[model samples]
Target: MADSTNQSTVVAFIHTYRPDGRLDSYMSELVDAFVRCGIRLHLVITNHIVPNLDSTALKKHISEQRLIEYINDVDPEFIFTTNRGGITKGIMEKTHAPILTWMVDHTPFFHHGGGPEDLFCEKDHCIISSLRHVKVFESTYPVLKGRVHYLPFATKVEDFKTSRNVVQDVDISFVGTYFHSGILENLYNYYADSPETIQGLLRLAGKIQSDPDTDILPLIEAYGIRKVLEDFNYNHIYLKWLFVNYISLNQRIKVLDAVSDLGLRLYGTDNWLHVGAYSLNLLGCFQFQKKIDTRQKLVELYQRSRIGLNISHHQAGGGLPYRIFDLLASNALLVTNARKDSDLFHLFGEDVQVPMYKNEQDLRKIVIYYLENEKERRELVQYCNRLVDRGFSFEDRVRSFFEIAGCRLKETGHGQLVKVDPDSFIRGLVRYLYRCGGNKPYSSQEKAAPAGGDRIKKIYHRYATGKQRLFIARQVVPLIPNGIIDMLRKQ
Candidate 1:
């Protein structure tokens, strides 16, 4: 944030690539809320995607320096940044405005986990010092202990408030990411792990994965076949067979496959190719909009949606999302797995508790009822809309920030004497390499899937996930021989 001759506070945001995609539904409301508080929000962004291509065309919507100049030109009071990389945040930290950082996903530790060799920390989740989960801003970037709070992402109330009740087109639509290859096997494993539930849930899972008769869970093979038919386009290279086989080695292949057969239109895009089955077997459902400035369009989507979907990968620390509030705010019903059950829903809602589905079986069984039960759906949406109106807007979050930041600054505390060095980097490195490599057990996908999507979604081909193929090699051999040899010699 820059010093503004103008009195309003300026808010700045950073993105991985171009400026437009970075602003999910939560941003505008956040800025509006800050402006309500008398601070003018100004945004600064890096127009680059890859570090090298971090140039002008990549930022066609807005230029990098121009963005900075705009912020400097207005010169506001507060500055906040969405981390694109260490470098992006580092620059913002240099500015006069207090820089607040938000982690959208358990992203810091993504892609690189579950591999034998360790990569850089920035490539994975970085825990500066667990302030005991307390909101403290006083450590090395001690200012963060003061400026930062474990502020989860933002949510808008539009979808839940204004969307007209419409029928959900597909029976079971698993929107986030899914593993396509071993998905079937993983599903079996989950049931096998709990054979008792197999008989009871099997029928429901089958119905959910596929609606019995009409199509293949075949919503795509039937209604949306044209959407899938377009898969031959250059956009779908990631959903191919070889790529699935590649990433599945170190990551989740079986899970993707199982989600495939459920037969609904699986949706994905974004840096979808960076990880998971974006390209792999996630074939037909891939919809790429040739990069457009789509903020207004997305806000409109929440209004049109009957049910907005948000699911987190198992390792993703609970599946809460900014869009959850956005969907609800738009008056759309949200069908999501619980993140931190107590905090997530309640934090976002006041009187109405948002509905949560436990497993694929649990979710499918209830979908029909929610659809058929329109009165109940309308009631839920209305109740949730009112709840956020009172408790969970970005305005609420920013006000909460001042209170938390203020409390910490006033605290007087004695610094602890070091009884010992924090875990040594060398030992910590060895342990993470071992555990991330394979020591830490991979969570099973079949167990990950709901009972049965006989609907036959997409059998996303085994995708390479082009990152390091650690997840793949692990499946082939419990250990990567070369990497294992290196570890033992070090030991």
Candidate 2:
């Protein structure tokens, strides 16, 4: 490892894949931020700057050998990735530069069966969107203790800038997909015959929404479904993904149904037209606009909409959605569901009380209140925009990333790091929110112990009985030759 002080301010930014290629906008924002900080960027991406190709396609274009050679040639000060990208230990071993991965989604998926150890070196660091993820990642992968940092999604104000003169024609806007059918749906259907099992799944989903940062295994065990999941060969991380998806689908349906009467202009896939409550919601005040193709179009929509609505993906845990910043940047007042933790109050003061709702009636009331009072709404938007300007931009994030990597910028321009006293800030934020009788901060370290109910005991016995047969086969099968085992299976 060479001294970061002696290293040149060059970075190889790895642009990973998103099916919709929405993340390319984020990559561009980071590149612009890095350039402003006097750091040269080598955009390591496929043809369109959005590496949306599958693994086979990616391998056909970029071979491991070529990637290694490219890294050796660039010899960048450090490497940055939004997700893991194609960077592997083989590539990491060939360069002195460290790796920095910003986990934009659920952290467990990254550390599932094959964890971050496969990609990150000892000095390599990662940034997670949720603080709950940060604590869990550190506790799970102890090697990367101080290497983990919490940085929620941020926007490049310049990218989202729009003309204030544009009329706010759209009353409300929502940009997301409808999870009509997927793994979560498949799991639900598989247990359709067992109402108790379905109830257990729904119960797990509800619990996850309430406390998303907690690991899912304990929750499953607590709900008396560990044996059922084991029967299907589903691991904890995979279950976590399924449960989060379930919560997201159900919650989106509920919220959209409540606000659908408010003339919501939804910009997403066609799936929204057929989903549960959305099918009925579409009949009243909902316009099914085509999915957005470009970043400019999405920003324009936000700028033209009086209220930009957000439903945080359950995967984000306590982190504010990236939409929050983008909508505010485009001068749209945001109305969102209440987040799990006090991150909302932590960023914007406890007094301003960023427009958030607890239930369907509450959502309708808040949206209508803001819509009727344009003066108050605009004032709130301006305050949040000022807060974003003071800090919380991608430029600040880029600087923080380098500072965490122990690299100093060669030249400073408009870029500045936001100085924050974590202890003081959290203390004040929590105290004020508590006084206001609002949602307080939740620590991921809090234990969520598994329940030992009679149902769970029955499941355990059944699981043990089923395992006894496999236990006997394992001892005897290995002693036989491979040819005999294959012949027996054929018979």
Candidate 3:
């Protein structure tokens, strides 16, 4: 449980850049919500950015020693970060505050090189994006017992609005980046060296692609691939990398090939060209974008397309990608491959809110059905939008954080306490009414001057009335453009 008496300050360590110089939009919504909740934020920015840390905040430092010094200076009650690499023994020893790690990606991707012993610390409390991942960690690492929690990705519903200029230029669309070259090269080398192993892997990949819900580990053991790999000293990490890459890339390519006859637009990095010789033609249909405008472009794509596709990596194990929230938030019809043990069907009823497919054939059939039947698609979009509006906003997520931290808000004369549960429909309805018309939660006027000032208050009122704010809060700096802060600081 959190120390309710001293829940005022928190220090966050995050990365601000990727190798490609693209800005990560992950922390904007959380930071905005924290400020609104009357918590002061102290940011520690690290410079070494990787895919796992892509969604971190913008600040640049390469030294861990400087980070320790800064955290000690702040003396915050809680420490927060998203990156697994950012947490180390040295940093853990330096701070007494509980370290909260909110993992946004799959466990295998971050825990590949290190053993379970090196991956977790005693002071860590983990909040994962998928329930499947929580199971994976608890079963794989003994140290993670009783410290893991699951919280899915949510949208800033107030920030994502239906665009006026709705043009269905593309019948279907996919927005994501391809894998790194080094990973692909490693896969290619392994495939060339081991023919039988490669054949078994290809079959396994097919099984997963045909049905993502398939339990792959049992299949690996049955094929004797696990034993063979162990004999060759390949280790579990190498096997994980091979399995994820082969399964994910093959499935993506197969989906694209199945949907090629339809009007499809691919928006992401150019690594799709290396998938195969015929991939050049596929790459021809690719669309690129300025790094800063990626989020805006995705919303536009969702609004303009009749169908949006979300492909979760095989390692996701029934966890949803960020794209699912974005598509629903934009009020677009989504067709995604089904995952094993996914909570999506439970959250949104089977074939009622959004359609899930078993294989590429199923995906194509569903996409065509929705495209031919415009009325059904529109209704489904409206249904999903209402669902998101009710309980999946960033504000709701912040409230969940408060619950997880055991921090109780002080009651005052004007404030009303409301309970919200993301999984329950009734609680979601109650939360929606409370947010839309009831007394404003998270108001700190009695404590200190409110964060974001009157601007945020006015925006909150507009949100309640179903009016779009002039600027979305999930942008890199929430209404302020990038580089402006640097200029102001220099002055």
Best by TM-score: 2
What candidate 3 gets wrong by more than 4 Å, as runs, is 1-7, 15-17, 49-63, 108-114, 162-165, 187-235, 288-292, 349-352, 407-491
For each candidate in turn, the TM-score is 0.48, 0.71, 0.69
After superposition, the stretches of candidate 1 with alpha carbons farther than 4 Å from their true spots are 1-6, 11-13, 16-25, 28-38, 48-76, 84-97, 107-147, 158-266, 270-296, 313-316, 339-342, 345-352, 398-491
Write one digit per residue (lDDT tens) for candidate 1, span 342-386: 345435554446777665565554555676787897688776666
Report the lDDT tens digits of candidate 2 across residue range 13-117.
444334543345556666667777766565654323212422212221123444555556666667776555545555556767777877766532331124434
Candidate that scores best on lDDT: 2
User: For residue 348, what is the lDDT in candidate 2?
Assistant: 67
Q: Between the candidate structures 1 and 3, which one is better when assessed by lDDT?
A: 3
- Give the Cα-based TM-score of candidate 3 against the true structure: 0.69
**What's the lDDT of the predicted structure labeled candidate 2?**
0.62
* Collision pairs in model 3: none
Instruction: State each model's CA lDDT, in order.
Output: 0.39, 0.62, 0.59
Please report, as a residue range, the 10-residue window in candidate 1 with the lowest summed lDDT. Answer: 453-462
Tens-place lDDT digits, model 3, residues 1-491: 23233346666655443455433554555666666665666554433322244222111212234445556666665677764645555567777777777766553223223454556667777787777677666666567788888888887676566473577767888876565536535654766777877677667767756654455668787765785555545545445555575667766877877787787787666666565565655666666443324456657667878888988776676778778887887756878887547768656656544688898899889988998999998888877777677777665766666566555533222221121111121112112222333233333224432344434444433342232322332221243433542332221
